[model samples]
Target: MQNLQSFASAMSRRLLREAGNLPALSGNDFASSKEIQRPLDVLSQGSGSFSAFPKSNEQITTPSLPESAENVNAANQLSAPVTQSADKESSGSKYSNWIFVLIFPAAILLILVPILVCRKRGNASMGPWRTGLSGQLQKAFVTGVPKLNRPELEAACEDFSNILNTFPTCTVFKGTLSSGVEICVVSTSISSIKDWPRSAETLFRKKIDTLSRVNHKNFVNLIGYCIENQPFMRMMVFEYAPNGTLSDHLHVKVYEHLDWAARMRIIMGMAYCLQYMHHELDPPVAVNDMRSDAIFLTDDYAAKIADVGVWKELADKAKATKEDGSSRSVSPPDLAGNVFCFGALLIEIISGKLPETNDPDCICIWAEEHLKAKSYSTLVDTSLQDHQADELEAICEVIQGCTDPDPMQRPQMRDVTSKLKAILAITPEGAGPRLSPLWWAELELLSMKSN
Candidate 1:
């Protein structure tokens, strides 16, 4: 019994020792084993078409994904040079484009600048000669006027020492050339610059151009321009009218009252000038600055239009506002405005009064009323008591037509000239000494020429 009990105790001790020696796995261990095996299962069950990586590098066959990755990496490597070459080509093209853009405008400027300079040089002419003031004297010799040397002009104007008239924009000096020819020097008040008031230089050039083209006995001729550098003076020169402006004759008591024939002669001369300007010239010059101040008489009493279109240039500065409230450069007055201005002058010539300053009773209005009433005798100047009534009425009708408010209705300068010429033939000899001695001599000369 004791032996049997000892055997059972030994068996129990052995079972306990075996059980303690073995490591026991919980539910977590079982889960980890299944999770690890699942990925291996998926790899082993991949499509049969792809073979696994081979042992020998020479026979290394890649599966589908690895082969695609290798091909993509190879494509990137091969395309690098092509992309770099395209970038280089694009960069070169851009550089060429930049160079072209930079050079084109500079090329245009280089071409255009010289052409403009040559055109300017071409305009330089001296009476029957092509002379240019490119290097030293910047004088614009217009028409066939003689190119007065700077030294000669300096001598004439006494180096701008004397001021005949001090005006707003320029100072006028009476000058005499070495050859005894008289000239008036007009100098700007501003110092030497490209332009004054921005548009002044342009207007001055325009004036020069107008004067250059005009060639009439009744239009003041441009002598030349004196543009000096050191003692900078921009000047325009014109032949001196010793008798002064027409304003002097009509307004000043020092001058003798113009007789009826003399007055008619003045009006006729003005019409001749207008015809020359508006009809004769290829591009007709619109002489709007038609005031007594613009008219100058020669020693022989021939009236010449001076300072043509200058005052208009000065007054043209302000921009004109459109009806729609937009601003634009004010253009020169149309031909109608010019006609109206000439009509104002007619009032002065007929009435022997300064028509410009007559405020409340504008002589034009008074003349219009008189004409409507057939008051022809009243239109004649009171100074000339001895005049033919029939001839005077005819003259009044001409004045009325010229001074018409509607420019379209007014007779053209050519028509006006024809009418005045007819009047001259019918005009009877005046009772008194009709004209200045010089003018009578000129008339006789003209008659001789006609014969």
Candidate 2:
């Protein structure tokens, strides 16, 4: 019985030592360790009903069986609390580890998702042609304007080997379709195309739609367009003008100097086209480009307006979008700007001066100075002498009104066309201006010379 008490006391002492040496996991664990240690101290001291340990020479007393059983029961009750506390501590540690494991990946996913989405969107915008034609070009297919492919364009342009003219923003290639019709292919280089903003593709499609709808004798006809992505090509095809640009006739002197009558006819053609655009169309299409080079001449010296179709691309090259690629605020139609450009073109035509040269002999400054002094003689082109004084005065008056300092004060294109018709002595019901009798004789002479 005494041996049993000593064994229980030694086991309690070992458990107390282990508990003291262990590190506490938390405040609750430390409190649990303290509560368990109190019972362990009572058992190790043998304070319940037995002496702690029997000495070698000291006498030992053996208790009754009931007393020994009671002592065993006390030891068991003390051990139960320690086992329960240990189980709780182990479970708590496992739960905390699980929480840490789950939270880390969730945080990483939150950070990565936005970055991936933004990258995908950027790539999609850069290659919008991957989705094929959507709004405008889809409807254009059934509207007489064909949607051409890269291979057909390549064959027509002779593998794009025939280059006609190269402008800063695009290249003009001369091509002949399978039907043996001549067409001009305007294409942008791949290097410069990379710099185009996201809105450039959208704007290009819209311009194609609008130009396809246009049907005017004085406007260049849009035949079809080609869109591709592998080599990144966007091209617009138009009817080839054989007589070349008005600038070529006037400034380059490749042909005979235009007489006063030829100039009037060219100006009248442009006016009629401008009137149609400004008054006839529902949402008026402005002549955004009015340079002399932009005007193509027919074999008969009639004017055909070109470059209006690709004005948006030309504008993008001049000015880029916002830094983040967002489009700028929408501006109202540029009808007033069109009126101003027409006035400048008129001055250029009359003075036979190139505004782009910006020389000391600039026509705009020269005309303004001469008109303020009412000096009509100096404003006429040096080559022109056959024009009557009254006719010259009427034309100068029109120029003055069109070039008014305030845009609001300028005459509408419709009014300008009416005044031009009146000056030509043609009624609205008349088919066209009566050809000058001398004009026919001169035409026959030129034809004979060419032959």
Q: Which stretches of candidate 2 lie over 4 Å from their true place?
A: 1-144, 191-196, 308-319, 356-362, 426-451
Highest TM-score: give the candidate number. 2
Query: In candidate 1, what residue range of length 10 has the lowest lDDT sum?
Result: 40-49
Q: List the residue pairs that clash in candidate 2.
A: none
Return the TM-score for each candidate structure.
0.58, 0.60
lDDT of each: 0.59, 0.63
Question: RMSD to native for every prediction?
Answer: 29.4, 23.9
Predicted structure 2: lDDT: 0.63
Tell me the number of clashing residue pairs for each predicted model. 1, 0
